[model samples]
Every structure is written in structure tokens, then in C-alpha cells.
Target: MVIKKVSIIGLGALGILFGHQLAKKMPRADLRIIADQNRIQRYQQNGVFCNGECCDFNYVTPEEPCEPADLLIMAVKFNGLKDAIQSVQKHVGENTIILSLLNGITSEEIIGEIYGMDKILYSVAQGMDAVKVGNQLTYDHMGMICFGESETGLISERVNVVTEFFEQMEVPYKVDSDMLTRLWGKFMLNVGVNQTVAVFESNYGEVQQEGPARSKMISAMKEVISLSEKAGVQLTEEDLDYWLGVLGTLSPDGKPSMAQDVEAKRISEVELFSGTVVKLGKRFGVPTPINQELYHRIKLIENRYTMIG
Candidate 1:
């Protein structure tokens, strides 16, 4: 599959980070940054800066007439996904491969349902510590993205094209055979780190400290592992320990995306993390007490923001 045209559907931190990298290698004409009018104006005025470089990619919105893209990347938050899907309809052709970097287990499912299942691919981004302040994106840790087919787990032609795309753009990525397992692994990480940081209103260093917050983080992660096993994903104790090791390696001052959203007074992705866990727990007959508690606590904080509005 020859991937000529590529479109990214969000201009958030991860979107800008990857878009900037892609713009460095790919022709400006081949890439399109999909955003709304306000964001388009912001980008038009300020541009997307990452690591001190400016992105020069074309920007478009749903109101504009555009051709379908060969590859479409969805980088929006979970709560924004439904509207994001509708916004990208004109950019998805029959052969367009949709890859989502959202932090959740069900994003691909939602995309597959709207766009045909065969067109959607499973993917997740990890190790990124990029922070967005206004239109500026700064980060020292550029993450690697993992993606592949959900069912066959085979290296298809499209998968090879995606890998080649990342390589050509000098972006780090991995093609996994068991993409579902990888997605669930990332889901567990988000459930533990993202929710804990948001609920405590702390950073990674604080979560690593010895306290009730750390205990709650571990308990929530363990519950996710149990639920994954019941769902037949085979996530084990070792995987949980591996994630803990990964967390330890992160920058002490680094804050998860949820924590950043909370600080900005914007809605976070709690629904994708603890909310999803609680929903799946009931389906699998597994008790997710830790996740339920975290979900309610985060909701209370979010409610205060809503009340102020």
C-alpha cells in the first residue's frame, strides 16, 4: 500500500509532537493537520513548535473540502472522540488506515464501528512526556508508538507501509503481533499512573513516594490486571511489575496528561481510564473497587470545575 496523503485529526500535545516530526520529513503538501476554527487560527498565528522547531504542515477543518487521506491518525482525547470521528469523515477513503493513539482499550472499537472494522488499526503511544502550554509543545522524552492488526496479528502490507512511514519520518515505533495485549498493557499503565496523579493532584515523583497514594495506584493497577486476565488478555503480575519499572524510569518532575488537564482546568480522560475499568469489571464479573473509588474521586474534582462554570 502506497501511503501518500496523511492526516492527523487532533492538534493536542501528542498530535503536535508527531505532526512536527512528520512535517520535518514528509512534504508539507502531503500532510494535513485537522483542527477546528479556533485551533486553526491559533496554528496559523503561532504555528506548532516542538523542541524549538516549527511545523509547516497544511491545516484543514471539517468545513473545508479535502480529499481522503491514505493514512489518518486520531490523537484526540476519549471524550472528544465521538465528534472527532464525525469531523474526519471526509478524510477517510476506502483504503484509509485509521490509527488511534488515545489512552484507552475501546477507542479502536468505537472507530471500527463508525468506520469499517477493516479500516481501523490498534495502536498506543508510550514514553512521551511532552507538555503543551498555549501552542508551544516541549518534551525531552519522545515516545515510541506500537501498532498492528487486532485479529490476525500478521504483518500486512499496510502495516509495513506504516512502519516505513515512521522510519522515513525518523520517528520511533514498534509493530506488535498481539496488538490487543499491547493495548491492554497501556490501558493498565494509564489506569494506574493517570488516575493516581489526577486524584492526588500530584506529579510522577509524588506518586513514587511511599504513601497511601502509591498503594492506591498499585491496587488500581492490580485490579486492572485481574480484569484483563478475566477478559482473556493474559496480563500477569510480571507485566504489572514491568510497568512499575517503566514508571520509575520516567522524569521525576514529569506529569501525566491527566494531571496537566486538571491543572489547566480542562476535562481529563478519566472516562477512558477508571471509567472504562469499572464498566468492564461489571461485564467480566470482576470487582474493581480501587478503580471505582478513583473514578468517583476524580469525578468530584471535575464536578467542582463544572460548578464554577
Candidate 2:
């Protein structure tokens, strides 16, 4: 499709990271930040800062009259996906390729149910330490985005076009042949690192250390490995070790999105991570006690913001 016009639905860490990178390459009018009126106003006023540099993006609302984007990126949290889907309705054309940078594994399926599977490209953002606080996002490493066709292994036209676009934008990416395994690997990493850090109110440094926190993190990830086996998309200790290595490269103080959510007193994506694990564990007859506990602990953290003393 050549990807001339691009629209992004979220301004989270990953969103800003890619948006900022694309903005540097593409014309300002070619890349659109799709948001409602309220969010547009807020973004215009507060401005988006990536690594202390302000981003000047073309902001468009759902109701605005414009041509559909060639590429649409959905980076909203799980809780906000519904609204994001609706907000980007005016921006989706027949040939538009959609990529979901959400943490969990179900976002593609959820998006595809409405947008058709043909338009959806499975994607995962890995090895990034970007953390967003307020309107500012800072990252030590710009992670590579892994994406491919829905079924994986075949580089389709859409995949090639997206790859070209990413190349032009100088954004790091990997065209994965086995996208499902990569997605599950990322899910396992989130199930371990995100939930564990959020629960303990610690940073990457704590889990990187050899201690109870690290042990608990590995235990939680082990549950995902078990469930993956039952689901026919198995991840091994090697994958776990690989992710641990990625975690090691991240800045010690960098907190994941879930940990940032807890610190900001915002709702986290526990339902997508450990919640998904626990649900699937039941279906697969895999005991996911670690994820179950992590799920409860994260929920408890969320409840603390609203629960009466």
C-alpha cells in the first residue's frame, strides 16, 4: 500500500516512541494521531514529549472528515481498546493495515472480530524500556516491533509494505515467521515482569537481582510456559532466559506499563496478563497458582485506590 497516510490511536510509551520516530521521517500531515475532541485538546495543550523533545503530530478526531489511513496503529490499554476501536472508525479504509501494540495476546483477536482478520497484522513490541509519566515518555532503548501475517511464516503484501514503511521511518522491527510463538513469549514476559513489579512496587533492578522477587517472577513465567504447552504454542526455558536477558539490558529503574499504572493510581491490564493465564490454565488443565496469586495481588492494588478504609 506504500503506507503514505498513517494513523495512531494511542499516545502511550510505545505509541509515542513510534510516532515520534515516524514524524521525523514522514510529513506532518501524513501521520495522524486519532483521538476524540477532549483528548486532542489535552494533547495539544500538554504536548507530547519523547526523551524531552516535544512531538508535533497531526491530530485528528474520529468525526473529522479525512481519507482513511494506510496504516492504523492501536496502542491503547486493554480497558481503552473498545473506545479506541470506535474512535478510529473513520480512519479505516479497505486496504488499511492495523497493528495492535497491546501487551497481552488477545488484542488481535478482539480487533479482528470487528475489523476482519485480513486487515489485522499480529504485532508485539519487545525489548523496550520506555516508560510514560504524564505526557512525557522516556526510553533508553527503542525496541524492535515484531509483526507478520495473521497465520505467520508467509511474508504477505501487507507485511512487506509495513516493513518498508518501518524501514523508511528507521523504526526497529522484525518480520517474524512464527508470530504466535513470539506473541506468547512477550505475553509470558509481561505475565512475569509487569505483574511482579506492580505487586511488589519495585523496578527491573529488583527482579534482576537473585532474590525472592526474582524467584517469584520466574515462577509466574513458568506458569505461562506450562499453559503454552497445552495450547500447542510452547515456550521453553530458553525463551524465558532470552527474556531475562532482554530485561537485563533495560535500565534498572525503568518500570513496565503495569508498574507505571500502579504508581499513577491507574487501572492496570491484569485481566489481560495473569487473568488470561488463569482462565486458560483452567481450560488447559494447567495449574497456574502463581498467576492466580499475581492476578489477585494486582486487583488488590487497584482496589486500594477506591476501597473504603
Candidate 3:
């Protein structure tokens, strides 16, 4: 399929970043966003901010689900997948490809439950720190997006074409054969940075600079990795090298998504991030004490925040 129009279902940090870049590069490609009606109305009536870099654009919510797009990029919370997909699936064309930029290993399966395995792609983004603040969406990391065939192996040409298009747009991207390995690598990152940093109420930089906090981050990642191996997802030495290297290079000021969620007092995908490992520890008959403890502590903190809200 010769991609033309691309619709992003979420207008949060990553969504706005991609849309801004896509609009700039693919000028001909119709870039539509599926946002909350209120946010959409605000942006349509008054331009939305890309984290202080505001843009005046025509954005509209579907009144009653019309047609699907050539490509659909999903960027909602993991728990909100079904609602997010339902909102935009009607606009997804028969040949549409659903690319999930969310955290965790179950995105493809979530979409596959409805769209089938052939239409889904599991993707991971590094160095991307996109989030919503009021009417503005900010992405300080300017990261890269990597995606490939899930289990279906049906969209080689389409994947390549989309990846090339991303590259042309100055989005750092790569395609790998072991997509699951890539996913687990990120899962480790989320377990470490997203959860631990959120618990610290600090950004990536603060955590790294704080001696005790950084130690905690390392412990959390190691535990998550152990949980992954127990679940039969073998992570190699090279994987450790790449991820550890990434840890050293991460933006000092960047905060993990979980931290942001906690600050915002929004329901997080903790269950998918750390909680997944805890559940898997049971499934694989291996105990993940560190992860389990973090999961419990983080849940308590999250609950406290929610109750406060």
C-alpha cells in the first residue's frame, strides 16, 4: 500500500510529536488526530501547543465513526487499548496497519483479538519523552521508533516502506528480526526507569545523579530481567550491553512515563510494566521479589495519589 493519510488515535505527547514531524515531512499525507472531544475542540478553536511550540491546525473528532485510515498509530495507555482502537478502527482501511507505541508485550495481541495478527505491529521507541501538559504536548527526547512483524509475518514491504518514511522524517528508527527481544529490552527499561523514577518523584537525570536512587534503578531492572528469563524470553549479553549503554545515554532531565502518571494522578499501566513480571513469576514458577515489592509499593503510592485526587 502506498501510504498517504495517517491517523494517530491519541493526541498525547508521542502522538503530537509524531503528528508534528509527520506533518512537516509528509505534507501531502493527511495527518488527523483522535483526541478527547474537549481537547480537540480547544485545539480546533485555538491551536494546540507542542510543549510551548504551538501549532494552529484543523483537528476534529469523528462524530460517529466513519472510515479507517491507511495507517493507524495507537498511543494510548495500555489499559485503554480497546476504547482507543474502537474509536479509530472504523476509519482504518482494510489494508490499514496498526502500530502500537505503548509499553509492554501485549499490544499486538490486544489488537489481534479484533483485527487479527496480520494487521498488528509491535513497536518500541527510545529516547522519546512525549507527554501532555494542559493543552500542549511535549517530547524532549526526540527519540526513535522501531517496529517489525509480530507473529503474522505478513507486512514486510509495508513495514519497510513505513520505516523508510519515518527515517526520511528524521525519526530515528530500526527494524530487527528479534522484535520480542527488542520489546523485552524496553520492558526492562520501563521496569527500571519508569517505575523507580516515578517512585522517586524525579526525572531521569535526578535519578542518575542520586547515588541511592540510581542503585535502586539498577536493582529494579535486574529483577525485571530475571523475571523475563524465567518466562522463557531469553535475553542475551548483547541485549544487556545495548540497554545498559542506553541507560548511560538517557536524557538527564527526562522522566519516565510512570513518574509522569503518578504526578498527574492518572491510572497507570503498572500491571503491564512491573505487574506483568510479578504475574509471570507465578506462571514460570520463579519468584520476582524485587519486582513484586516495587509493584506493591508503587501501587500503594499510586493509590494514595488517586485518593488525594
- Highest-scoring model, TM-score: 2
* lDDT, residue 212, model 3: 73
Clashing pairs in 1: none
Write model 2 residue lDDT over 1-309, tens digit each, in one string.
588999999888988999999999999999999888998899999999999999999998889998999999999889999988898988998998999999888899999999899999999999899989999999999988999986756989889999998988899999998899989999999999999999889999999999988999999999999999988888999999988998899998899999999999988889999989989999989899999999898898899895843
Q: Order the candidates by TM-score, highest first — what do you get?
A: 2, 1, 3
* Pairs clashing within candidate 2: none
Q: Give lDDT tens digits, candidate 1, residues 1-309.
A: 788899998888889888888888888888988888987897888777887788786989887888899999999988899999999989999899999998888889889999998998789898877778777888878878889999755988888989988888888999998998888888898899998988888888887778888898999999988998888898988888877877787777888999888888888888888888998999999999999999998889989998897
Model 3, range 1-309, lDDT digits (tens) per residue? 666777887766777777777777765436777766887777777677785766644354755454567778888778878888777756666788888888888887888788877777678877676666666677666777888875433448878878766766776787766688789888887887788787778887766664877777777777766766776678765776577677667667766778878887888778987788878778878767777777888899978967877
Q: Over 4 Å off in model 1, which ranges?
A: none
Clash number for every model? 0, 0, 7
Top candidate by lDDT: 2
TM-score per candidate = 0.95, 0.97, 0.90
Q: List the residue pairs that clash in candidate 3.
A: 67-91, 68-90, 68-91, 68-92, 69-91, 69-92, 205-252
Count residue pairs with overlapping backbones in model 2. Answer: 0
